[model samples]
Target chain A: MVKKEKDASTEQRILDAAKQVFVSKGMAGARMQDIADGAGINKAMLHYYFRSKEQLFEIIFRDSIGRFVPKVKALITSELSLYEKIEQFCDGYISMALENPYIPMFVLNELHKQPDAFVRKMFNNELPDLSKLVQQIDEEIKKGNIKPISPVQLIMNMMSLCVFPFLAKPIFSILMGLDELQFRNSIEQRKKAVPQFIMDSIKR
Target chain B: MVKKEKDASTEQRILDAAKQVFVSKGMAGARMQDIADGAGINKAMLHYYFRSKEQLFEIIFRDSIGRFVPKVKALITSELSLYEKIEQFCDGYISMALENPYIPMFVLNELHKQPDAFVRKMFNNELPDLSKLVQQIDEEIKKGNIKPISPVQLIMNMMSLCVFPFLAKPIFSILMGLDELQFRNSIEQRKKAVPQFIMDSIKR
Candidate 1:
């Protein structure tokens, strides 16, 4: 047998397989044996690269958080008006989620399971500083650009609108009897509709 | 040992234990033995009552859907204005969720796992008709009672705002560094704030 054990492609293949397994089954349900099978490697080899499932998840989660948090930081920190920010954020975030459909569930399920360790590791670098957004919202309220709403509440509202559908997509689709194409169409409409909904609610 | 089998209390006990096991571990990870232990019954007793985990989940799910869906149907079908409907929905739904925090995760997780069967059983009676709400929304738009918006979009928006908080509560609390009291307080404030937020956006 060819022993291409230490190669970059082999490592990438393992990561790809781990991402799929973790995304589908979540941390509690995932099995290392399944990951090894998905990666087409022996369990010994899977362990050789990553000591355990937790470690593998940490690496994958770090990669996901890195990509997700920075964009949010940039969106909030940019010198756009609150309305403009809402529009751009909804568009960017939804599009990002569409492209990487598994990330939200993967991060959230694990984060809920292990909040303290997950949050600490995710925010270790302090990349997406929320306080900056808070201050910006405060300035907007002071300037009469928007109605007085709690910055945290506004953040929560915006996030919940943009992300919840994806998080609960499978259930909503089945419950509402929406076929795949129809569900996607609603989301497509939401890119514009969500921003409008938020703006109308908050604009002075 | 005196056999006290096929009793009503024993059935209720098994049900309660099943709900807890299913909520925490989800269907894939839940075990029959755990439910038996939780109910303080032997495995044979549990099986004698429930036949299988799938059957147990079906019964529990039917009970959950019964309690939850009717309230929503009433909220929509009541002789209330759109504004009143939105207000009642946000307040009632939030309060319901706060009291039974486990149900959202329980239902959504199971529904996603088995979409077809779950939805079929949940709506077997053809309950909580969405069309009634959709018709009401159309009438409100015609009467200039609110801004023109798709009924489905509005329902999605309101639902996303109210329920996502509970669904993502544990993760949000940790991510935003909210303590228990703080999270509870936010939800408390949300009962009013969400309604106002929705009203402001759509009110003509």
Candidate 2:
């Protein structure tokens, strides 16, 4: 049991190092030597544990997507009102992204290279059905609580409002002439403001 | 002059081919040989024109950002009402991005790799001042025309709602079980609906 635990720790160390490097450099640019160096392990050990870079990347990508999906799913599945759910989603999505800002870019970048494989894996594994959230939007529309809009459009609007800030941070900061502190504070402010904005638009 | 025209066409071809390869593979993954093949030019000609992959990528990145910034600046500098500006921004941003869907992800992914460099280049070029938009938001708030919200937060929300859908297209398509037709329609719908949503929330 002690030996097994030690093996797991070493594997995790390799994964953490690979995640950092892969997220920054991506698949084709990342080298086995660099991952080995980052993990404080020898090249032979890296191959022994993961066998290949592709395998290691797949593991990390899966784990990253898995981490993001549940929080998003929680927002969709919650019993909160449509307004409350929008708030929860905006807050939760941004916070989750803040913790791992690189993951979205990493996933999207890799998927651009291997769309069929990544899309299949994502659908087969991580994403939850948003039909419930869609149903909620429809109900709201029917009740005349919100303007007439498709569930997909409404959900996409809510998501775009929440995620684009982080995705466009570089452009936003440069265009606005904000430094790191100001940029972060601006994001923090959005935590409350985005939900309210969404609620205002949709709530009758 | 004839020789100069030939040189210009060659440079244009390389840039166009490089944009396609770079946007798909990113900087780290793209190879000189691949770019040469894409451009239907020999590797020596590619070297003669651009010298290196980095040079080629810089040209593409600068051009892509330039294309986006002008429209954004126009929206900012316009004399339209706050609500009208949001509508125009949604229309302009989405249309530009759809015409070049790869650009937002390409700029964003590269920015993650070298944020300081991206910021410097972005700011060295023309960009819009948000003071006008900020003043508009402040006026709206003072009159209680909309909920009191920071203009920065409002901008972030507007961007998030507008941009995230394109950035997360694969994940969204998977989660929503949307076929390509449905997904395309959804985007088209948001081009109209997003502005209305933002207007509904903020209009008195």
Candidate 3:
């Protein structure tokens, strides 16, 4: 059991290192040697654990999705009122994006390269099922608590408003003439403002 | 004059081909040879037209900015009401993104690599001056035509909602269970829906 625990820890260390290298260099440009160097492991050990770069990348990509989707599921499934859910989701998602700014781009870039495989893998495994949330939105509309809007579009709006600013951070910062601190402040502002915007649009 | 016109035509041909290659392959993966072949020109002529792949890419990127921003300026500055502007902007931006589906990723990837240079160039050359739009928004707020909101935030929301689905097309499509036609239809839905959502949020 002790040996197994140590092996698991080492595997996680390798994964963490692989993520950094892969996110920066992308799949086509990433090298196993660099990942091994980042993890302070030898290439042979990397091969022993993951077999190949493609396998390692798949693991890393799945791990990335794991980090993002569970939080979404938790927030959407929680018993918070719809307004509160949007607020919490906006704050949580924006904070998450800020912390791991590269993951979205990494996922999107790989998806562009291998659309069928990545999309199937994500849909089958990591993308959260939002059926409950969709049903809840329908219920709310029926209750006359909110305006009629497609739940999918509403979710997409929340996501785009939360994520795209961070995704386009480099260009957006310069376009707005904002320094790093100001850019972050703008995001902080969105945490409250986005939910308010959505509530304003929806509340009957 | 005839010699100059021929040179200009060759230059344009090289640019058009380079945009195609660079947009599809990205900067790290694109080759001058591929671009030359696409243009139906020899490598020597390609070099004569644009000194290096880097120089050629910058031009292409700048040209891309040219295509998107002028339309933005035109829409924002036109004699349309604010509601009409939002509708037109959503329609125009989505159509532009569909037509050049790869440009956003190309621009974002290059911006990731050369943030300072790209940001400076965009700010200095291509970013539309939106002071008039901002003033109009403020005026609308003062006159109580819409709820009080920061013009910058409004612009950001409009951009995020309009651009992000296209930018994250592959993942979004799979996540939403949208095939190509369905995805296009969702965007078509947004042309009216987005402006209505915005109006609902802001209209007094």
Candidate 4:
């Protein structure tokens, strides 16, 4: 392989490894040596690639926000009606979360630890533009398509329904005596249940 | 004050300080010195009281579980009707969480870090007795009093709706440009909105 190709492969490996360590151990507990080991590279390569854990975490955090927010923006702003959007979001998000269970907690924990970086990445240019979704909800209310509820409250409900299960899975697993498959099965149940639940509450 | 009273005061102060530090900084980032400083006692007194950070954290963690689980147990297992239980849970849990914003994340994060401990404290007696509540939902469904739904799914929905906002508050605050009072007003909205949402979803 060419030297440039090898360099790209190594960089990708380092990022994947760093993301795993950061997600599992969190920002405070994760160590550079751990990331280097996970990546199958020496300390020198890890340092040469990212310089500091903060810099590497910034990359991962930025990438997570990039992957999550824009899709949400697109879905809400798309031509689909609000009910269709809710159904699609519930189905798609649960499936996505089942595959990438770490993202919800990792992003929230890191954001809790450091909000400034996330705000900078997500706040400007209406990149996320939640106001737009709020506006959409308002328009729906105007048409008497849904109950007269606060848009922000509706947004909060949609988010909580979709996101909370992923973070709370382990706790409930222990509480409910659920094995891994059982928990995932319950999550699968939400694919239909959540959308139905939301539509039931909001439909006029 | 007597020596016993004085010692008790210092211990209480230490516990309060440690709880705050653990909640804000998490298990990995919190320091003994910070707890000591916050408690207004030197490291020596702190050591005399708790011996080690692990011991101190264990006390605080167990205290938290003791305070939280028993109340929920009583509320759910009480003679209240299924619908009343949901309404009470939404109303009471939100109000409690609003007052003690730190506990949910702190218990969750610490539980994430060390499940063995939380499990040991909370696992038996069905001390929290979630199955009883699940059974209550099952009976309601059987009697055709409420729409058919999996008890587990319903529980997950209620938990998500009530808990996610506290963890996500800062991120949303920045996103929505909501100051503390406004954010609080939105939470107040949930006191009614969440109960209404949950009831609407489940009522036949």
Q: For candidate 1, write residues B1-204 as lDDT tens digits.
A: 255766668888999899888776777768898999999988999878777888998888777656767777787888887778889889988887787776777766655555667666676646466777789999989988888998878888998999888877866776577898999999999999999999999988
Give the per-residue lDDT digits (tens) of candidate 3, residues B99-159.
7777878877767767878766765656656777888899999998999998878988998
Residues A1-204, candidate 3, lDDT per residue (tens digit)? Answer: 145664447788898888887776677767889888988888998989898988998887776666666677777777777777788889888777777777877877777776778766765655666777888899999999999999878988988898888778877777777798988888888988999999999998
Write candidate 4's Cα lDDT for B7-121 as tens digits.
Answer: 5598899998998888777788788999999999898988898888889987887776566666777898798898788888888888887877777787678667667566666
Model 2 chain A lDDT-worst window of ten: A1-10
Index of the highest-DockQ prediction = 4
- Give per-residue CA lDDT, model 2, range B79-110, as digits (tens): 88888888889888888887777787787777
Error of 2 at B70 (Å): 3.7
After the best TM-score superposition of candidate 4, give how far the Cα of residue A133 lies from its true spot, in angstroms: 2.4
Which residue segments of model 4 deviate by more than 4 Å? Answer: A1-17, A33-45, A48-50, A122-127, B1-16, B36-45, B123-127
Q: Model 4 Cα displacement at B23 (Å)? A: 1.7
lDDT of each: 0.81, 0.78, 0.80, 0.81
Model 4: how far residue A188 lies from native, Å: 2.7
Chain B, per-candidate TM-score: 0.80, 0.83, 0.73, 0.83
Number of colliding residue pairs in each model: 0, 4, 0, 0
Order of quality (DockQ): 4, 2, 1, 3
| Per-residue C-alpha lDDT of model 2 across residues A44-89, encoded as one tens digit per residue | 9988888788898888877777766666667678888888888887
